[model samples]
Target: MTDAPLIDPFQRAVNYLRVSVTDRCDFRCVYCMAENMTFLPKKELLTLEELDRVCTNFVELGVEKLRITGGEPLVRRGIMTFFDSMSRHLESGALRELTLTTNGSQLERFADDLWAAGVRRVNISLDTINEAKFAEVTRWGRLPQVLRGIDAAQRVGMRVKINAVALKGFNESELFDLTEWCASRDMDLTWIEVMPMGDLGNEDRLDQYWSLKDLRARLAERYTVTDLSERSGGPARYVRLEETGQKIGFITPLTHNFCESCNRVRLTCTGELFMCLGQEDMYDLRPALRGSSDDTALKEAIRAAIALKPKGHDFDYSRQRPDGQMTRHMSHTGG
Candidate 1:
């Protein structure tokens, strides 16, 4: 092990990494996919073997948590096999957690094999529970399939979290309804505010952004919520149902940015390293791995990438998109 302390610029332990194995996704969600989008060429994306090498190096550098994400991770071929290779590292106790984030389109088909491959937690992106509205948002995904995936994941005893981006005019009204539904099943729910990463036509759409304070105000009218003293993964502000066993959270990047405590380094589909969600900086690791036998050089590149992480991001989406902000579609970047 490197034995280097995990503190970043803010002195917070940075140990978790979100790796986007592929940029290609099966569904075209409104937030991520442009109406007429062109995806990257096949040759431009990283191979599964490349992803495995990066994961191994990250573990060697004190990263214990690994979350596999993509436009949809399942869209990549031989994903279970990739996880199987990663499992050897996990089983040897080099990595503590192996998780995934998916749109749930193909989760049911892959969840069992994934769990068997050593993935213990899974996050499913299901914005709206309404079938018609879901179809409207996802454009190509069927709600039933998503729901079935969620059910299968839960039945398999995996850590299941439902991620919903609370859009202003679209699904904001369903916040409380979704919370209650989660309570019924003792599930975890994360309500994320929409960030203006790319374009969606309306600039003022961000003006309607709701903070965690706003969400708590609305939910307090029904159930009593108590804030948890212990902080868990990433920047999510968490609260537990006062009477029920459900845990509900809000990831309010727009109003209350949490970059100070961010412990993540996102790897893009083509093996580019993004230090922060809002910054456009990247270091090409694939070429280095291909050219150098210097493992130290590779780890140094990772360190340099971490050193360049922004303190936090400004959520002024109404203004022009930040210059050099190279964040791809949220799906592609593993939102």
Candidate 2:
């Protein structure tokens, strides 16, 4: 076999990996976990050791950024221990950064260890600011706990960013409030357009996705916003506060597709490697992990999966139709 490493068809080098630790979550978010999901079969999940070993090999193959994701990463057992082990590499500079994307339900308990484990950045999913609305969106999850988690995460020295998924009829009015709160903390807030890939996901939600032009216009009427291009890997359009150093981002998945510069890959909790959110193609990494596949072979497999990455998502093409054709839910893929 040729020893040359593989790159995606777009020449995008795969350096970042988002690993889903579990397919289960504490909250039943309308756009993530379905209301009827009881439990995932244990047999399909990868053990902790297996996940770490894969991560180790991935790091050796030029993966520098690692983000722990899940239905809720904190919900996974021994996450702090995992962070402890992963942090050594980060501290040694073998890994450039370690981060987590969570719902912030259990962050208060794990935030300290996570920061000590070399985790410096955290993304918390907060869709609504209203307590009743939060409860309604998450089925029965407590908004206070989520808010407390955010505060705790900030206290632990992690750069906390609130991820708000803007749906048509839900959480739209709270956009300004979320941005203002983030500005006060000197942190960032990202507003992502709702994708039609979860339980509450459908063509209607995708259609209702607010456009970046519209969001910017609304914000401009109140505050003086300056556009910036400092972020290239992220999928959001960047903007900085005129006076404060705070930044805000808007991801327009419905009105615009960002696959041209997308540099991220997602690994499901069940061990499937997905190249794109809209595409169903995936490479099963469980066998490779179980069989002790070498780095060269593993790299090839990952590249093959990326080669299949769609040119772009079909949300804009199906703007009018409710493309109820998503392969996996966001909770399963660690939204």
Candidate 3:
């Protein structure tokens, strides 16, 4: 009998994988996690070898692109070694692309090495241009450091993208300025709504959830917009500004809900396979991956997990956990 992979019940082809190497970050963002956050223990995290093996298995199952994320993937030790081993797959044509999402706190140190390794693109998360406002948002005073990281990343020949999470009464006033800055530098930029996740995710912040739909309308007022010809195989849709030749994208997960075209899944640092970001259903991949390295069991587990993927995320913000609160942090879920 011939062996062929089974598609999900929804018929969406899963071709992208987001791997969170760690849950510890150098900065504490107000919208992402609790102010006093406790990170995962070292033993609970997957080793570089296990990560490499699981990634190879995903490649065998048709996952072509991989994005490394974290509470700051760079903050995790030995990430460079991890990238080195994975780059061979890209070189051997086993993988098409490898990318990263970072706070840009450490980009100045690792960008050149990461480019030489295999990271084709880098998305730096920056919410504001003002120094004090940046500190207020990320709860850290590292904007200058982050800015240097962005410059270093571009200088290393890596394609750069700026990721901004639009929050009301915060950086919303700087939207026009942020767009102009990215456009002048010829970098692709994206704006996403702040997702309410975890027990730390308070309903009060829901007031800060600015819709990208409204932002798009504001954008159309000043620029001549057109559709982009390329697709990164992820959720964000791109529009090209005819005047500046810069491409801007909007990821409105809370407002527009791109679950209809969702073709991705997330693997947490501890090997939990998440089918939907907004749902609690997950397959503990660590169980199948432990000891002696059974590739067969891992593949079977992966197939089973894929079959059970929900058709879409039921983003009912009112849904509450047993503790009378929601409890999924974006950092733990790989953003």
For model 1, residues 1-335, the per-residue Cα lDDT tens digits are 35464556667677898998877787778877766668889888878887888878888888999999988889888888889999987899979999999998887898789889888888889888889999888888899998889888888888888888877777778887788777776679988877666664443444545556777787888888888866676878888888776888788876676877788889888888887787766777876777787677777777777777777775654354333333456755677
Give the count of colliding residue pairs in each prediction. Answer: 0, 0, 1
For each of the candidates, the C-alpha root-mean-square deviation to the true structure, in angstroms, is 2.4, 2.3, 2.6
Residue 106, candidate 3: alpha-carbon lDDT: 98
> How would you order the candidates by lDDT, starting with the best?
3, 1, 2
List of clashing residue pairs for candidate 2: none
Segments of candidate 2 deviating more than 4 angstroms: 1-6, 199-203, 206-208, 293-297
User: What is the C-alpha lDDT profile of model 2 across 86-156, one tens digit per residue?
Assistant: 87778778789998999999999998888778888898888888999999889969989988988898887
TM-score of each: 0.92, 0.92, 0.94
The most accurate candidate by lDDT is 3
Mark the 10 consecutive residues where model 3 has the least summed lDDT: 317-326
Count of clashing pairs, candidate 1? 0
Tens digit per residue, CA lDDT, model 3, 1-335 = 01244368899888789999999998888878777898888999999889998888887788878899988999988899999988888998868999999999999999888998989799999999899999888886479999999899999888999999988889889988999999887788998877767766454556777778788888889888897867666768899888888889888665566788778889999999998887889998887899446688888888888888887775543433222223778899789
Better of 1 and 2 by TM-score: 1
Candidate scoring better on lDDT of 1 and 3: 3
Best prediction by TM-score: 3
